[model samples]
Target: MMARDPIRLWLNAHLGLVYVFLYVPILVLIALSFNKSGLPTAWTGFSTEWYGKLVANPKILSAAGNSLIVAVASTIISTVIGTLLAMGLEEGRSNPWLDALVAAPMIIPDIVLAIALLSFYTLLNMSLGLHSIVLSHAVFNIAFVCMVVRTRLKNFDRSIVEASIDLGASELTTFRRVTLPVIAPGVVAAALLSFTLSIDEFIIAYFTAGAGQGSTTFPMQIYAMIRFGVTPEINAIATIVIGFSFFLVLLSQRLNREAAP
Candidate 1:
């Protein structure tokens, strides 16, 4: 057995502390969501009253509906475009500039992108609403989806494509029969990832949501609630959102692992 180094022990201790610091608030929020009193500091008993309240809130429900529309639309657009981009980059000659351009959405600051998109929409006189949010969310979602699919593609065997061609299979036939099956898991992972990101996105949505209650998304609604005060209902909503995001991320990770060796 390797000896435990003192430096390694110290590093691990610091890392543990960092993780605790990061997740302690989330743990507290989740725990508070079960409080019967709906107060953060006081927990009379365990209850799901706040969750029920969240369900009954029309504004929250409306926002959730808008969020679902945007997430679904963005996921569909991002997954298709991103998968094609990944395939093109993987099969065709690499262009450094093109790669950089594709990656810019992922690398750029959210506020910067949000403002830029808002400005562009304004200049184009585009009506800002759920559609605008969908378009904006797709910009980054596409990059994320492409990156995920590209990871799966990296481990792909090019010889399979060559073998298909050698067998006189058309490109479309080979892609449908072989390439698609190989990449299906990656596609699912990418779609889940895109959906999660679109659901959680706020800055761009806020900027492009325009002056209507019709386009308000769940994240924007949550932000509005947060500005007022933290309530047990907010905690419950947050817990649900966190759980949903966690589930999607776990699903994506599992699919990605399956797509790997």
Candidate 2:
């Protein structure tokens, strides 16, 4: 029998502790969401009244709808532009500076990006609303989508595209029939990731959303609620957002794995 390595065991133990530190709070939040009492400090019993209240709140519903609209719009725009950008970069000679430029959005602080976006909107004399938020989110999400698509493209068979082109097919035709099919899984995965990011995004949305309740997103709504004080309702909203984001991540991984050779 082989003996276990002490170093490997130690690393595994440390990793487990790290995960517990990260996720234990999330688990506690989820539990508190179901608590009968409104306060996190006092857990009277398990009840879903908080979630019920969330459903009954009209403002919550409106905010959620705005979030959905922004997420869908931004995801669509980002995925489309990012996919094309990834393909263009993959086909060309790589430049380190260009790569850095492409990755800037994902690397920059969210607040920095938020302030930059707000300034750009002001320069353009654009009115702040859900549409502005959608554009801002698309800008933020483009880098993530491009990175994911570029990773998928690393394993792509380029000869297939060349062969299609040689067979008297136009670039558009070849893209639709050959390149698109090969990268569809990656594009879908990127879109799901983009949607999740847009849904949870608060800083940029808060800045670009301007002065209106009509453009308020779910995260902004949660922030407004928090200023009044944390309650079980906020916990419920957080729990749902976390669960949805987790599901999207899992699904993205599933698609990526299935695309693997």
lDDT of each: 0.94, 0.93
What TM-score would each prediction reach against the true structure?
0.95, 0.96
Q: In candidate 1, where is summed lDDT lowest over 10 consecutive residues? A: 1-10
Candidate 2 lDDT over 20-87, as tens digits, reads 99999999999999999867769899899999999999999999999999999999999999999999
Candidate 2 colliding pairs, count? 0
Instruction: Candidate 1: list runs displaced more than 4 Å.
Output: 1-4
